[model samples]
Target: MSTRPLRVVVVGGGIGGLCLAQGLHAAGIDVAVFERDTAPDARLQGYRLNIEPVGSRALHDCLPAHLWHILVATAGDPGPGMGVFTERIRLLMREDAPPAGRDPSEQTHAVSRVTLRRLLLAGLDDVVHFGEEFTGYRQNADGTVTALFADGTSATGDLLVGADGANSRVRRQLLPHARRSPVPGVGIGGKLRLGDGAAWLPEELVSTKNMFLPKHDFLFTAVFRRRETNAATVERVGDQLRAAGLDPDLLVQDAKDDDYVMWAYVAHRRALPADLPADLPDVPAGGRGRRLRELVAARLTDWHPGLRELIARTPADTIERFDFATAERVKPWPTTNVTVLGDAIHSMPPVGGLGGNAALYDADALRRALIAVGRGEHDLLPAVAAYERAMLNNGFAAVRAATMYLRLATLPSRTVRTVARTFFRLCGVLPPLRRAIFSD
Candidate 1:
């Protein structure tokens, strides 16, 4: 291996890029991050993340101890008891499910995305050039790649990684002939503030998060307790409600200034009727709040009144929408010089919570690959190829699995939906069996 420290340029500073940068930096490699955003705090990072053991362990194995501590402090524990539910019965899928194996405490965490981002961002000592949007790139015959940003800035590195996210400009520039991933579905989410001692449902339901998989649709809801930092951020959420068509002033008055709130994500397959004409390429907007409410009402009408109550309380301005679509696979990963990670490489359905875990794994695995290359056991290009092989293999499997789960959740037939729910419920009850299917 060359004694020279390789200079790496990572596009996109989200989970994968940031984590990889952190891991690479820890290895004493020269790395820099380019973020398209004008600033890190320009927009509030949305919602929570539940990184299961596999994903969590990957992070632990890669990130520094202090960063991990910060993540844990900001994290919320969702006992294994928090699970997939269709009405009252917990739906189970997987062959390893065993009787009495479903324990809420054994599960992972519910960490706010902002907290995770902060943890990763804090560990970076290298300058992450912001407002540097990636426009294109060209590779030299010497195997070096030059990346061009829209702001007329440029960087040449041993390798270029397209961690830029779903609409990756680097990915486009690399394979101009490849079909850009079409928007497959729309995702809408919002946080709802309710009465402190609100009468909603059983304590078990309110104490932990819940998933509502109705015959017509699916909804993921998390009850966010009021926190000091989030409280200030939520103040403006009221204005968003008004913009969405709900009375912003009325919404603020309905809940105490200090009451905890519920955050909900409502998704519709793009193949379905365009619920909102105006959300965005892959996220939600306040203007589509009313449309989202209608979708929720129509789908979960038969499940629980509590859901309806929450939806009813949502302000029109608070709703946001986005489309969810990703690349089928990425090729030509760098082994000696560069590699790709996170949503930059494989974008999957969030149903199985694989996105974060897979990203962490990429960081861990790529680091190992780089280390192997350093040991002279494998050439850089070959090592990069190996990483691509493994990641894509895993990516295909995850994308296919998540897409199936999504279809099952939004299945049209009551019988099919019931069967799907029952299958997952059975898996939940049977630990070994559920382990076979759901355990990564």
Candidate 2:
């Protein structure tokens, strides 16, 4: 342990944590990442995200030059014919809805969760410890923090960050009183190498870029594709596929998990005005994607022909359901020095895709705060308080916005849906609103 350098422990190795570690290290600060997983090769899967300027800027600013190239390599190869659609690709308004502007030329690359991790881990000098699940933390009066892990491992650092996802142990131990918001709806998605004739779904629809669909039933389909990789990864992911209620046998081959391109669709039953019950549950329970498909079939699809067509093409096994939960912002995130970042702090619905971006932003901001405090220029407590003030304000706003977007896509009324499409269109051309909507 180098007493000359500050010791920092980041509990989660997700986007935010990885970015934070990279940023601090680049700034000549010593940091270590303690990920619950044994290696980056194991158990991490999610669709591609639209990395906005906030996260893109942070990633480029924090990581090295080569990392940027890696991102582009993993990006979706959106072909020429890709177009934005409302009721269906052909059913919408006469004036063509332009595609979501993706700058393939930019530094931000659309990448798989694993690739992003690997990129961040580059040149890190192997400080990351795998299988070190966070148990808890304690702060000493001397300004040092002690961390306990599930494997009976303990480490001490100057500061602790909980970058763990929604089920963060650090957050639970620290902010025990904070309320856990149930996902307003269920989401299910999967990836399958498209069989013959399935190529009509444009490569753009499933590639590095994300595609959102509105079927007859209020179901929303989102697709993400990643290039192929190795076999063990495929096996683990294959096991995941086998566990699904939908027919896994339909998938043509068991390919490498990383290489196997896939799509994910999420639907909200509780989002429906009729399905929403009076009392909302405190903690979200649904994690299975199959439940979402069932809800979609029952509630959303009778009206749209295209929606039915898309659903008909989907193999039952591809759908994996999860609840889009958020944690209500409360006081003090830790009992001692432990604090949460990213989804652990504010787990918003993925509608805005702002969850990861917001977290990395927190990493940048919090690292600055810590640096300021360490230099004796500012008080640590107040510095953290100021950070939380910004975090809560922005986090709450994002949650509200994300939920609204998901609600609209899942069950858009004629007028509201029309306005949404128009607003998204205008967002491209309108400078001020674009700044407001897309600004940090």
Candidate 3:
């Protein structure tokens, strides 16, 4: 067995990095997660995450029993599965019902990214270091990796895992040739509060998650009931804040009722005319909620009235644009003492909704590999090599599939859209056809 303690340095304190730290801690390994954000509430946590079985399992396997309970308690109700529809609200395919032989355990769960991260941060008081932006890493002559942070500080560790998301700095140092090309699409998303007397949206449409696939564009909407933030939960989080030396009043705002409808509008990059005013009003960064609504309305003029109304009624400050990009196929590198997971390795478009789940799976696999190496059951390089091979093979395949779906949804030619609409309509009515079309 290796005499030195396995000190793992994880860059990026997102889901993948946090989960890996949790798992390593559970396995009695020393791990430290360095995140760029200054604090827990430094930035917007973004929208909800649809965690499938793979991601849920990663959490379950990594988190302690109590933390897992908190996660499930705080998550939104897993209503029915996703519903596919047309711009006119016509149902094309309902995937709520699982396939005949699918396992119940494979169902998806909806979770708020903020709440999930907070829950994962529980009991990890000393492990996660926030506000430390990762700059790069250097290999030491004594078989160790030293991670450099923007703060002019550094930490040496047995291994470094880059989970810094799509635009990872660690990945740049590791594979400078790796490419991250922008997928030719613009994604605008917003949230609408659907509380008392706010029944503008049809119940059926908001009752379950729906995806409206119109010609040359795509839209997805899901209504999630926010988990009640009870006094106990707030108190717990407050304690965590104090432990981290942050002000407890950071969360002093009264919690709002948990009823909101979130929706996203996606279109081809060329959908909007090139001559659109470049100097069109500018909203402060992170303050583009209203501008996002206006942008959506302007770009989706030909959409259905109901769909357009949703965007119109949405509060301006609640809307924002999502930065979308796809990762290039990364060539394998020597697994020496550095590696990467999640978006740092393979990032795909959101059309397939596979990126998060794949990241979870990667964390789990990498955790197991590191554990093996720690136990002296396998050499470090070989174990990491095996994990990378499997991850790249599956990850890139998912990327290709998502790219195909994105193209299909954003077809430039009208004839292609017509044929796709016809085929989807047929699939909506025919069970066999639906199964075949959606079959894994």
Candidate 4:
């Protein structure tokens, strides 16, 4: 181990980047985070995330106990389990069904991405630099690394980590050949306030659930049932945030909402025939909350009435369309002072809902490796190499698995859909088989 303290420059202030920073900071390692977003609310923080055991464990290991408490406090209402259904509300696999590898102690929950990010940002007052977009990096002859930002400023550190999302600049510079291609689908998603209307949705559907319609489209819904947010709860969260030195007001806005439901409609890119009305409006780039509801509603004409009504009644401003991308395969690179994690190294479709979870796993694994190096337990280069090896093996496998699952789910063949549905149903019955099929 080097005599000097290990200095790590993380090129992204996302979940993975922040998690690594927290762990390294806790371990007494010097780390800095650079984020392009000017402020915590620079953009609309996305919807809910299904945090699996791997991700939850990472948080448990990386986050300070208080922050972890906040995370659990803000978590959505607990569901019995995830359910799969058809467009007509035909139950294919119920959440009440026994899971394959049931671990009652290892419970997974849905959390708002925005809330999770805020919790991760806690106690990093001086470590994170906002508006510092990473442009690239250069390995110094002295075995150090210099990360350049768009503002012409740069930070030099013993090691560099590209936890930036899929379009990571560091990954681009290191492996220019690695590029993300479009998957054969598109998605329309939005959030709705589920106040009294919560009674209108099916109890199972309003809970954590996925609806796989036979029409090559899918709907995923997660309801954030109202939680007790009286003065005491607010004071507790406020006190925790202040104790962690985070801005208490950062969470005030979110606490105002009692309940919400996030929903998405995903389908093959070519679901709409070319012969359809050419005058259909295109979703605006920056608009949100229902801009594309009509276009999506038009495509879902043949879907179940309930599903179609959900789209049609959606507040026009909440809906947005996302063009899906094909799975990415990262090419190997020589290990050096620079490295990457999360989507920077392996970005895939959301088919398996493991993208965020995998990112957390990457953060935890990389943090462990780097902490070992900081403690002189391992060499820096070898530590990074080992981290990359494990990351690629797991990350690439996730990408491939998500790709395969997406292909099968969205393929316009009745035979393939039947087989896929049957396989999922079977996995529920066979715990060993479920363990094999479900990666995250």
Candidate 5:
């Protein structure tokens, strides 16, 4: 290895990438993050979040104590367990929020994705290079790696981490055989302002992670109420960053209008908006909200009246669209200076609340492993090999579980539905069963 201090080049500044950068700095290692977004507030992000345990723990591990507190301080209390319902709002069962098996101080039950990212970017203004799109990377002769960029600028480091989201260019270049196949259908989703849907929505829908399993499709809905408004969060987090020797004004986050209900409707490609192409890569710009709402309104004609209205009344611009895809068990490969993490290597649908959490888990796990190398406790290559084994095993397992959970809603078997309904009903009265099922 070169005599230079260890450095990590993280491509993509999403949850995983930024968190890893924070952890690396906390560990006294040198790191840099590159993101394509022109600035932090350039892209609008979904407001709701359902952070799982593995993810929450990772956030605690990777972020500093004050930063972690910023996440908790601005979030609402964790509500009761999520509820399951029939198409007409029939209560099937409710699975209470899992018990905090670990110390409560280490847990972050819930926080908006937007705010979580803002906190992740703390104290990294100088480390994270925005608007610099990553193209590819080449392994250096001295065992370092050099990351190429769209603008022809380059960043070389002892290691390269691909934390880019679902369509990671790093993964494409590093593992050519590892490809993401689209799920059979697409996900049509949007947000309904609290004022618009709360009055008509059932308490079960308002309070829990709501689910609707119709004859052949699924509808997932949940409320996202910010304890502090976006404006307040921005100012508070900005001050917190300033106190931590970071400049927040350089890439301040934009405030949102209001808290709302987030919902996703999963169906075949036929449910795609009439005006949009089926093979479109992502949610198109400008007319997306109106187009997705049209598709959802048509599909929910037979749903509950409240749900129908919720779908019908959701603002066009607030509506979101996405295609479905899942990452399978990543085939094993030789360890190198370059590796992958988060959605770049393993991604699943929004169901089961695993995607973001899994990414956080990857950040913490890799952070600790690399920290060991920085501390001279192990060699870089060996440390990475161990990290990849744990990461791939857990990451792929989470993907499989998330995809399976989503598939449960799409299964056409009447028998399967009946069994699931029975299980939910059974959990209602059985304390032991409730503990077993919701303890994750």
Candidate 6:
């Protein structure tokens, strides 16, 4: 170790980046985050997040205790169970949350994406820099790295991290061969405000997330009920954070205006129209949303009327359309003082709740490796290499798993679809199989 303490520069202040900052700050390490967004709520896509065991562990390990309390306090009610249903709302199989495990980290948290972003940004006022565009990075003769910005400014540190999202500029400089390929599917998601709720909705729809299998696609829906409204939850949590002398105003916007029923419709590429504008990459989300809504609304006529109404009822602006893309596995590269994490390194199709969770895992894993270096257990460069190796293994595995789940959901094979339906039918009967496959 040198006489100077280790310092890290993180680009993109997303969940993964902030989580790493939190962990390093807690461990008494020097770190700074450069973010392009003007503020925490600059991009408020009020989508709900199902933080599984892995993600739960990451947040718990990274966030300060008081903020963690806020996390628990604000988390929506867990789905607790999942029910696989046919296109017409007939239950085929069900899987409950895993039986209590020895690992206390085996808990689940359902919160809004916006809410979690705010939760992660707590107490990092001095550490996080906003509106800083990271153009690229450079290595010095002394082995330190410097990140350049759009304003002709730069920040140098012992190590630089690219926690930026899918279109990471860092990855481009490091591994030009690595590419993010669009997964062969299209999806649209929305949150439906449940004012007094829909009368035709069944108890199963409210109690658990339901996967509806149409002829050649999947419709996943879940009910979200935060203990309080988004404003109230933030106000209550904000009060506690202020009392603790923290950044009370960090969480600016409501996670959602009210409790809602969330839904996502995914279609197999094989079923897509040859001239489908749905796959056009340049269209804005609102336009793509209108196109996707027409397509989904047509396909979902065979599903429950209540579900149809819910999708139709989703406000136009709140409708979101995104193409699934997975980043190519990062091949073995020479280790330096620079590295990448999260969607910056491994972008996955949206499935299995793995994308964000896997990124959180990356932050924690990298934090642990740095912790080892801080303790003099490993040399800095070698420690970063070892962490990269493990990160690639775990992160790409998550990408593959998420991709496989997406394929299974949207596979157009008649025989495969039959097998899938039959398998779900069996899961309805076989207790051990149900426990094995859907352990979550």
lDDT of 5 at 364: 91
Better of 3 and 4 by lDDT: 3
TM accuracy, model 5: 0.88
Best-performing candidate as measured by TM-score: 6
RMSD in angstroms, candidate 1? 7.8
Residue 387 shift from truth in candidate 2, angstroms: 3.0
Off-target runs (Cα >4 Å) in candidate 4 are: 95-105, 230-232, 247-258, 273-291, 299-303, 428-436
TM-score of each: 0.79, 0.72, 0.87, 0.89, 0.88, 0.91
Of the pair 3 and 6, which is ahead by TM-score?
Answer: 6
Local accuracy of candidate 5 as per-residue lDDT tens digits, 364-428: 98999888888777889988999999889988988888787767766667788778778877887
299-353 per-residue lDDT for model 3 (tens digits): 6688778788888988766676664689999887877889999999899888657
TM-score (C-alpha, index-matched) for candidate 3? 0.87
In candidate 6, what are the lDDT values of residues 1-440, reduced to their tens digit? Answer: 65567899999998899999999999999999999998867866756778888888888888887877787777776576778888778878988666765353567777777667776776788999998999989899988999999999999998999999999998889888999988887777887776675655667667667787756788888887776565676677777867655554444344344567878888877676655554456877667667667777887767778778877777766677667889887787999999999999999987767888988999999999988888777889999999899899999999988888788777888788778888998998998998887786
Arrange candidates by TM-score, highest first: which order? 6, 4, 5, 3, 1, 2
Q: Candidate 1 lDDT, tens digit per residue, 199-300?
A: 654453455566666665666665544233443433645344333333433322323232334545444474346435565656445546777767656655
lDDT of 5 at 104: 43
lDDT of 3 at 155: 85
Q: Of the candidates shown, which would achieve the greatest lDDT relative to the real structure?
A: 6
Write down the TM-score for model 1: 0.79
In candidate 6, position 215 carries an lDDT of 64
Instruction: Please state the error at residue 415 of candidate 6 in Å.
Output: 1.1
